[model samples]
Target: MASSHPNVVTLHRVFDSPTDPYVYIVLEYCPDGDLFSMVIDSERYLMPPEPYVQDRSRTDGCPVPESPEYVEERVKLDNLIKTVYDQILSAIEYCHSLGLYHRDIKPENILCSADGQRVYLADFGLATGERYSTDFGCGSSFYMSPECQDGAGRRLTQYSTAANDVWSLGIILITLVCARNPWKEAVLTDDTFREYAKNPDFLLDILPISRALNDVLKRVFCIDEEKRCTVSELRASIRGVPRLTASNYETWERLLQRGLLKASRPKEHAQVPVEKNTFSNPDTNSSPSPSPVHSPPNASWDYGPKQGKFGQGLGPFAPTSSDDSWRILEKGRPR
Candidate 1:
């Protein structure tokens, strides 16, 4: 962890203890606590004035109020969400570049500095290599992806990817927007979670929670790998940055209905055989064949959206839309 990421908290020293059966790791601490604390605090401040009862179930005497000001306070709360989401996306993108998957992503794992400006991704104990068989199962039980758990509650073996990390990100987002767990009413299990995930009733025509934020989270938490918001797509969603012409979120809704990931599973799981280059005739006109076959100069990122191209910088966070409608939502802007 320390050797690969320059921005990550460095492991300056390690100590071996014969008295205990483990090696002690020295980590940097944030005295102000972690993102979990902030989330609890944020939730407290964001509790709904009244429960969002459905129209059918709502009583005649009482009605739901307009969406909270926090949702649109661009400068203060909205910008804060954008900044944290951006930083989180950057950290996850960095790990993906190194082929590392943070299987466990929850409020607790993200640490915030005293000023709350710096958010750090911590707790690598459940972190694992991306390209591995995943039925083995590793991650926070509550936030684990639907694909990870089994009837017996064990993680599946033939799985794990950058997509899983995104799944966790979606859950974190739920915590942020709803100010409470969205699936609180459902059973906390694999089947239960998937059932709810497959059908998160956004109350689209019902009004109330507002459409803009709904559009944003739906894209962020998409289940299908193809349709699921890629890192680049997600980075843009932060700050309500709209890259699409329409912001109603229908395309994402269709994604859930079409379920692109399942159809592409076979293609995604098909691994290429790695041939060993034990002995090659280097002098055998290695440069004679000018077929223009090329390899990337760096593993970090591809410069464009082409086949077989790679680039870490191509994230959802990048700016793609016109600035005319998009603005850095400030506190008073909506607050």
Candidate 2:
């Protein structure tokens, strides 16, 4: 999945060893926590103290940041929940744009950044799309899309279109606000999972989400392949809340425009910009690590005070920082 969409998760390095399970993976860590945890700890997240446009603090009473005791909680639960959906939509769209389908799209598997800038769709253990395929279904029965659960009994072909991923995304979106699986009620049999897949609309309508969001889910969660949305279509459809899309052209432009903006930014300020750090050629080194610079959001910061690190990245050895001994401050602390 990282190969397809680097922003999905920052894969630090790929290692291979002749150890048990054949050590082969690119590891990473999420600074914050998963979406489920964020929701479960609802009291901890307050809206900005000031208006959201200019600042990013909580609006209600300007509660202490993440302070369990001072948080204002929210009067309306819908906005925070919608944020989760919005973030997931952004990640899912990035994957789909790469011709990939995150066969897995459940909340537990989705991780949030420490800064809350984005959500990541992790565990591509069973993911597939364009140049990839797996015999196993990637997500829990509760979130499986229709195509992933029907036919030939647990076989991969049962429901394996890009739309299948959208179906699972729909279930996740509903769960964001409702906080429980809606299908849990209708799905009674042992194959309750299968039963849920049998009727997505009936399951969705049960929650009473905003009419606009509901409409988007209606299309993505459609049981029939012909009516359902593919990764690209699903992304464009949900570009705006309460409104699927302004029109086809508008949707494509937004998607394209985002891609253009991301590509145009200077490489280093990628990965959904935090603050920013510039790397001189010396830090690049020999080996092949995808410098933190590849992800796209890094280029938007004021350049200077570039940080240095010991690393061997993708291109031939090159100096990474101006100073011979410069260390990046990781959070705080001189590195």
Judged by TM-score, which candidate is best? 1
Model 1 local distance difference test score: 0.46
C-alpha lDDT of all candidate models, in order: 0.46, 0.46
lDDT digits (tens) for residues 238-301 of candidate 2: 5567422122222223334545322232333343232222322234434324433221122211
Report the C-alpha lDDT of model 1 over 113-203, residue by residue, as the tens digit: 7466677788777677756544434565445554554423333446546766776787676555433333311223433344545565442
Worst 10 residues of 2 by lDDT: 47-56
State how far residue 116 of model 1 sits from its true place (Å). Answer: 2.6
TM-score (all chains, Cα) for each model: 0.55, 0.51
